[model samples]
Target: MASPAGQFHPWRHIITFLVITAALYALVFFTPGSTAPKLGIDLQGGTRVTLLAKTTNGTTPSRDSMNLARDIMERRVNGSGVAGAQVQIDGSNQLVITVPGQNNLEGLTRSAQLNIRPVVARWANPAFVAQAPVTTAPSTTGPAASPSATATGTSGAASTAPSSPATATAQNEATTPATGSSTVTTASSGQGLRGEAAALLPKAASTTDASTTTTASSPSSPPPTTPATATPTGTTGTAATPTAPATVEPPASVFPAGSNPGVLTQPAGSDEAAFTTWETAAKAYANGGGPTCAQIEYFQGLDVPDKPLLACDQNGQFVYLLAQTLIPGTQISDATSGFDTQGGHGWIINVTFKADGFKTWSSYTTAHYDRTGGTNPPPDSMTAFTLDSQVLSAPVINEPITTPGTQVSGSFTQQSAKSLADSLKFGALPLAFDRQESQQVSAELGFQYLKAGLIAGGIGLLLVVVYCLVYYRLLGLITILSLFLSGGLVYAVMVLLGRWIGLSLDMAGIAGLIIAIGITADSFVVYFERIKDEVREGRTFRSSVPRGWKRAKRTILSADAVSFLSAAILYLLAVGDVKGFAFTLGLSTILDLVVVFLVTHPLVALTSKADLFSHPVWSGLGNVARAGQEHRAVAARLQSKEA
Candidate 1:
């Protein structure tokens, strides 16, 4: 039978270490693609963009707001699968973003300003219309002669108009003119007010003489005392010029007419007379042939949140007349990507609003939707969602979204839906950001830095190997082999972590690994020194190995525990590249304990039984003092204890 001290089963520990090492190697090699840890921006070239925030009030943003924006931007970047992206606030109003690999910089930098507003009117972009071939012949007279006219004719005149057969038929059903009244007819139900058909209604009415009159009235001005009329003499004759009516000024309740360019108010009543007049004036000013860019800029400069806005979609293919803001983007509390299973509309962004947002949304929808519980709602009952002054979507409010919130469905792919959801979930930045700089870091520079780091690490590791061999001599072989095993295990763990958790390795992380070499060596030295002390006190080398391990294990564990605790604290508090250093340090510290107990201690214990350890010089324990004064002293103490 084996002696009690010898029965530690050291071979079992060796087997366990070998098995674990083999398993880790298999995992590292078997993982598809590159098994190396992912590299960060400092080690791998990537794009960097700097943004300067522009506050509405022209003042610097608060530090808290900038930090909040940075955090939100980080979440958005990470959620988009760009892991290890760096977003930092520079000064009070600047943000610097660095991301690895090729990414959508435009999407990353979007303002994501979500605004919900009522749809007053919508028209096909004139540019888009002009690009398509004109199929219908031009009308000879009346509203058809002028693109600026805002009248949809009564049933009789609607037939003679140059509008397509489908348009006339749709308009006839949607609008009904009051009998004997020359005023243009409009749908009382919001659902019926939609598209070109609604816009054509006012133009259609221009065919009648009485309906063509422009009213000039405001809150301060009394109603027109006498109606001015224009009379045409021939079938295509020019109208007899009538006396000009008084200049009608906009009500003070909205714009003061000349206060700002393009500022307009929502017209009241179901007739939509005021909306038609404003639409006509806006189209003439916006679509005039001077310069589309200049026109758009002028309109954008004058956009007011509480007033109606005339803006185009991002593609500029459609223009929308948007009502006052109902709910601002700040009210959006959360957003997520989902599929519209019921409608088979592919992907969509689900938005949740806060309590105040819910109340605002509920009130708006209740006002726009048919409260009579009717099946068909009005077409004008829709709300448009805008980002950066461009309309993203305009969905009709079928019912009040009183639950969590509503969904924004569009012609969206999975990526686009997720991107939009990420933007909305993060909420809008407190201020708009202008791109200050955009540049790409070349891979060559990153590779050069990486090479330098690797060289430094290699040199440090080499010095450690030389020192161990010089000091411990034959025993250093065990330390060297243990280090080799620990290195393999640590590398495999890094690769696995990168594959599973998107952990990226950078220069700082390499420094952490280099530091671990020293830490790991210390544990071996402690164990070996403990064994040397035991031998000097007269215990045989074979018994001293096991006795030394028990004494040294506690010290090893305590030191490693402190190192791990410090690393944990650093990782939790640090940001940017420093986090990489802390994480690697903590990970390597754990693996060091595994290697020490399993590989290093067992090998030392088993080797103590060999003839090499019998000689103090060969065992690297110095003079053992066998049968000398130290041994006699130890023997005397043993005898006294037995007595």
Candidate 2:
């Protein structure tokens, strides 16, 4: 009997699948940076660096700490403005960082703690003043602190500060805030921050002019009210101290916004002991003839926000006495690097603060702005932005920044700006990491693995196809087409996912795909066997197709559900390559369901209606179809005898 009109449209399902497949293929070939699926580090030439977590107490790190470290490391990698970088935790104490191509992983494991402190005092670096300090005995010399401070305060400008010369022409344009969820764009040009954030640009000059800036050996002419002691000392540890008080007086300490005026001291709980320690270090470096700038170990315990820090600038040109952190890096919500074209700033990093941070920043800037000496702000007005133990910049508060964000501007290249921005954006890791092993994977080796995986997959597919053809005959043609369509859709999906979510295919992922071949074939066998059962019950091939599908779908769905659940469990419990395998397995299982329902069954139904394809021998149902015919003949003869 002819099928009821409009009950089911096999052509509609087939056409829809065709359209979707065509669109996916078009995107794969035509979309920029999405031409192919991303390959894992194991399949692409790269460097693998394994880092072991180190706790302060020399004990094993906890699982929660390790997991948090992994998350932060992943964020750092993403922030590095690099593509195809992977961070996976191994066991409970190790993290494996993989970067594709020739990219380096230096400094990736740093704690990356960022602190913003007020500058107490600044002077020329003693090491630079005394050229003969190199010959001095280690004990006699000051601490050989790492290069940390930048001479110019705030690398460029506070996020709300006026754009400098480079961006002066574009000053008329509004500087929009880039939030964590939004795409970063050039505030002036309103274009994506690709050149500024994604890729490295030209390097900027490292040196700042020495004339306009004051040095330890050369003091700027002070105003009439300035203190007499405010003068630079030569290369000795006896650097001059500025007349202004070194510490923020209680009752007027930097407090949170909307706090009671009666409340004194910063929220960091700076105590007299911390101040005494800071004073000792500062006095010894100054008149006490203590360790000079070069002898101060800035990296040791400088991250303590409650204590004052003594450190040197990156160029070793200036040493700074910084107060306790005014705005912790943790309060920063977003940081993006972009060029300030109209402001003439080469490259600047814009930092957006959280709600509390915004109010604190506003109050701090307002207080300092009021203390400015006419056009130039005093050292007390400067704020030092430090990453780890190094001072990145100490820019002066030019104005009371009531804005929600601020930018760090300086002599920066695209690469340096992006690096700083990424660090600030990702925040600090909970624990420190020491690199235990680092190795480079050669392209030749990756190629070998890729070839082997392909060969294995190809062989598996061939075996499945051969089995189907031998057992099902002409019906096997339907199976072949279904597999082809399924593979095509999966391939296209992988490419799209690679572009969108940074999914990469590895050796284990290939194993998952190979297994999918078996999965798809199993569905085919189940459905075909159901149709054979219907034929054995004396139903015609045309009627058996739809009825068989109804019964087989439930079984196929149950089996696929089990497989998917297993993959999901494995994905959650496993790490590294095992997770990749689970991910691909789950993805393939879902696609199998789609193919069986929309592509496979529809084709079978259409074929059953054709005379040539439905013949018992040609249909690969010779015995079953013949038995159904015999049963029907017997039933008709019985009816005739009864009449």
Candidate 3:
């Protein structure tokens, strides 16, 4: 090893530190995404939610599924314009989501499964069914039919059953209370409900002269047709239809009960019987209309996408028999909301599908078009866009959509349309998640915490600087410079880390930084004390600087090693904000080593060599060095006399 006196390349070491610091500053200014250190949610005030994964079959979710769900969830939160949102997998089946400054957790946490399904049938409130006589044209082999008919009900309100699919936002109709006959008007209600009633009743059936009216009591039963009360409209066709068509049977309904609605309650599995029972009751409403408004809202939470569902509008005014999903939300690539200028429609959400989705949607639209194959359109030709079990929009396939854009227009304000568009933009979660825990921090409180931490740190740093200057005199300048240098390095590193790895600085991390000031200051204290001890032992300040550094550096490294090791262990064992504390501690410890070796030691050594600082008063070695000098002179005289 080089002697302490020989290893005096102070300028070289100082140049190295300057170069490193310069490089760090250069990166801070030049690198993209390295603007500033990212503050953690706790410091910035935000909501944190922990979600537990759940499967339909009640099995533990796989790691891959958990990771995928986390990525999608993060994307969703970010897409919703929540800044600094983070999603991290905590365990095999748990996810922790943190959003800075957002309180609306609904759109951030929904399954958001936006599926397109065909409307198999429609059922109005039995109490509100029109009493007016209905008429229809004979079944003919032609592409012509009369215009749509309107049903006037007891409430004197008419709902136009258009051949085109109706938008999700229909007229604000009155809703009946769950138990009584009294009806109330609801202008803003969420989407309809699903239920499990098995009793079938005589539901009123009405249709225009252009349509057929049929009713089925169960999934297995054939639809029963009622005799028309009015004469059919005559139409010209290639083949003339028979006049006596009273005995002809009605067409079969297209939907089937593939799953049980009651499965939503059952933990073991779905019951097809339960689904059949609900289907029967729903069909009673579809065919004749008996379910009260109360029953509609009471059973509205079915989430089975693979089977037909009996659901109602938000107002519980009408129930629709919806077919299985024709296109899943995953096929939707992008969605946006804006005002409709052409049709004067209110705020509308526009969805763009992936290639496969476009093809499937086109085929469904074409197949359901009234002119396709010169046959009447399927009775349930309207397509509904559903999120979970709620019907968002059910519009008729007015024309074949071979391209990408599909508009969902209804009674939407700008807020609602934008909300739905954001939900659809990120697609759906593969696994369902139940929020296990939620925590929120307010901005005011977080700012207070941050202020308190900074004040405490400033006080500590101020005291340290004052103590160094009081005791070490001019040498304290080296300690101050070292502290600033270490701080600069740490700040630059944190900024880069925040940009590259999303490492955020939280309150606990600020505590770590405060503690690090002491750790760094300790190094300077150790080195300076060793130099003072050498001067007391009859050595010159110049020689003592190198010798002191050589001895004290080992101790500095050892102390930093212990600190770093402890931090590493803490980081590995702890979770949440504690990890932030440990990480910052460990990071500062390493940087302390760098500052001690390059900046602190070099500057101290260079100062010791300066003629001005070599004097006892200027060097802060005053009385100790004077006493050593006197002892050295006495010993030299004695040695010369003995020789």
Best-to-worst order by TM-score is 2, 1, 3
Model 3 score (lDDT): 0.61
The weakest ten consecutive residues by lDDT in model 3 span 190-199
Models 1 onward score TM values of 0.53, 0.56, 0.45
* Candidate 3 off by > 4 Å: 1-7, 47-96, 100-441, 629-643
lDDT of candidate model 2 versus the reference: 0.62
Model 2: how far is 626 from its true place, Å?
2.5
- lDDT (Cα atoms) of all candidates against the true structure: 0.61, 0.62, 0.61
Per-residue accuracy of model 2 over 1-643 as CA lDDT, tens digit each: 8989868788888888888889989989987665777787777877888999876446789999888888888777643222446788898889998776555676776686778788765544444434322221122112221122112212211111111111111112222221111112223332211101100001111112121221121123221111111113342333222122123322322222222232211122367664755444453333222223434332322246665666554444445666777888899899888877664546778888899987987788777742422233355566777766556565545456656766565556676677767777887888877779898876534888899999998898888789889878888999998998899999999988876545778788889998988999999999999999999888888999989999999999999999999999998787667877888899999999989988999899899999977898888888887887898899999999999
- Could you tell me how far off, in angstroms, the CA of residue 548 lies in candidate 1 after the best superposition? 11
User: Which residue window of length 10 is worst by lDDT in model 2?
Assistant: 195-204
Ranking by lDDT: 2, 3, 1
Point out where model 2 deviates above 4 Å. Answer: 1-7, 32-45, 48-101, 106-110, 114-302, 307-427, 430-439, 443-449, 496-502, 537-540, 631-643
Tens-digit per-residue lDDT, 489-584, candidate 3: 999999887654457777888999999999999989999999988998888889998889889989998999999999999987866667778889
Model 3: lDDT of residue 268: 20
